[model samples]
Target: MSPDRSQTAYAASAADLAVRALDALRGIGGTAMVAEHVERAEDPKAALAAIRVVGADTFAPYLLADAVFHPQDAAAVTQSFALFPPPVSTPDPPPAGAAEPWLVAWRDWAMAALLARLAEAEPDGVRAPRPTGAPVLTDPDHSQVSDAPAGQGSDSHAAHGDGLPTPDSGAPDDSGPRDTDWQRWSVRMGQLSPLALPGLDGPVHSAARAAPLALARGATRAVLRRDFPTAARITRWLALLGAEGVALPLDPVPLLAHLRLHGGGPRLALDVAIARRLLGLETV
Candidate 1:
């Protein structure tokens, strides 16, 4: 029978044999190449061998996908040197302790290919990192929030009484002030800037002030303990605050403890968030 039209009986038989050959091709690469050689060979047995090899080589990934929702192949294919996205290595770090290496050459051709694949993988855009799982305080008891009123009075009320009280009243009222009478004003707890609190001064001081409250309201209350995402959100917030020269309670001990409890990647990620925050980057 001719290879093209082995006609009636042989066509059906060959197709079945071909399928079996393909199935067996799942395990080895060189074997599949050899199998293709066999399939096209004058001998029918040769063709079957090639297809078998190819079939065997292909089953592992199929079986794996069936077992777990792993994106390993997709990640691998996308991360190929020639097909990765530009953003994948943005601000790529310098090799540890070595002189800075210029990436212009490495980025020349491969970058375009990589970006193409990345675009296909993420049609819209690369997703920003986000905390996975429940919001730490989504349905928080909020008893604390309710208790921690912004001002001594109500949100709308002035300290002593009436509408907007003089801003001076928001300051501390010293017994007998000399210069700067404004210093004599009695500032309400939440009315005045937390920074201006009596002893709240330097970076460490501000950190100390907020640290206790955050710890009390956060750690002790299982805020950072139960919710990693919330902890990350707080880390990002504090980082940005630091950039603005605003002090934050971000000692490594508490930060690491939060991360360890909540479970997230890289301690340095927190540092990046803080840097971004300080630089006026949007945390939202």
Candidate 2:
């Protein structure tokens, strides 16, 4: 397969594997059943299917697949698909507080376990720190950046301990186009035609299409290479819109609701917030 086609195919395959694995776990029924499944499987697929039959079919397998193919959200490592909260027994309260304790605990445990496994699997420490989304990126808005003259924030960024530029800093470029990766990336960004994602129109669609090129450039230039915050943001959005083959939402509420339905975390939450803020949806 051509590179892009191959990527698309691989994504479809991974998703298929994830769904099948979850199905298997559902078949198993409960914690004990999942453990038994794990004991029997040699490969991840078998392991996932085994886990699927269990009642708490962890989203770990699908989340892992997402990370392998997309690798944008560090949170994905711990994201679980296994346990769906049982229906609320009592009538609805006037106001809800937080997610149920068991659900939250399950998510945390899954995330933490995945993080530990990732650390064990990759000893080189070459990857960027997976984001916990505690402290936000705190960069000025992308629109603000784009609105500024080409050279704005091109320099004067705070240096990291290792001296790599921070997220807000445009990719390291010299005094001219040769000085930075962004310039080259910008050119590629300009060259890319907007993809016809579902429901996308006007500015939002335009921004979504252009955003990936900027992210792609960042990935290629070793700017937060393994850190997939931006890419994940884009992918999750694409998945939702593409799934229905509908236009992307003009408003953020639909998007936020969609994320909640799909399962959400710090990264997806942050993306929803950012996208809302950027599009002026928060003001509405």
Candidate 3:
């Protein structure tokens, strides 16, 4: 097949996958039920199934964090990780708000929670050395650094210190791609303006901090890396945050569709579509 034909075929396959993933998500009832299954299920397989249904949507990190921290089965936990595509060597950047203070905070919290779980699951897992010159996680709205020394602001330090997982300290495995990719993305995102919503009364940053533009860059990076799970997760958050009054720099539905057509797999594409529907951004 010609390169163009192959590309077209791949897009068609991805679109079909996105549709199926959306259907599966809709059939799962709602986020409340998905969270319940992850938190209360006695069987890891059942939880994993529910998670698969949830895919990389907004609630994924929450559900995954719960499973990671409170493992029903170690093998199941490992399997759940596999449900996500392998970490692409060149992941597309995260969707808009990837570096927004609120989103970053949430992402860091979820990552930290997962790392903590990994630490508990494998007491003797091989530890990787912490990378030097790593980007420090910061609150975009505030100038305060999260990793500040203990005495500077005890309260702030207590609240946000090390919320992000350090790759060298407590990684689930020796593979550094996840951390490396995430760090690189974070640094890129940090260069953007604060992700404040339109018409919302808050600390105004420069107009350059457009949400849609930021998200577009993020989605592209995520797609490049074939990190569909992260792509889906970021898309959902973008929609949710936009609904909560954040201004989007661009229409997300078309952007998501573009990603679906270009590189994202079915599950990832479907996840974005589902988020768009839920946010009333578009109808499936």
Model 3 over residues 1-284: C-alpha lDDT tens digits?
67776555545533443343354444533333333344554443445544433322323323222222223333333454455322332222222212224333322223223433443543223121211122233333323232311101112211233333343333332333433323333323322111221222221122123234444455555556665555554555465455666677545666566556654455555555555654664344
- lDDT per residue for candidate 1 within 226-276, as digits (tens), equals 444333433433443454455444442355344545444432233223323
**Segments of candidate 3 deviating more than 4 angstroms:** 1-21, 24-216, 223-230, 262-266
For candidate 2, lDDT tens digit of each residue in 1-284?
47776555444433443344344322323333233333443443434332322211133332222223123222222222332222333222111222122222322333334434544452222222211111111122333222100111112221111122224454544334323433332222221111212222333233434344343343233223332333334433333334434353333355444444444333334333333333333221
Better of 1 and 2 by lDDT: 2
Global lDDT of each model?
0.29, 0.31, 0.37
* Cα RMSD (angstroms) for every candidate in the order listed: 24.5, 17.6, 15.2
Count the clashes in each prediction. Answer: 32, 34, 17
Q: Give candidate 1's whole-model lDDT.
A: 0.29
Name the weakest run of 10 consecutive residues (lDDT summed) in model 1.
130-139
- The weakest ten consecutive residues by lDDT in model 2 span 146-155
Give me candidate 3's TM-score against the actual structure: 0.35
Using lDDT, give the best candidate's number: 3
Report the lDDT of model 2 for residue 185.
29
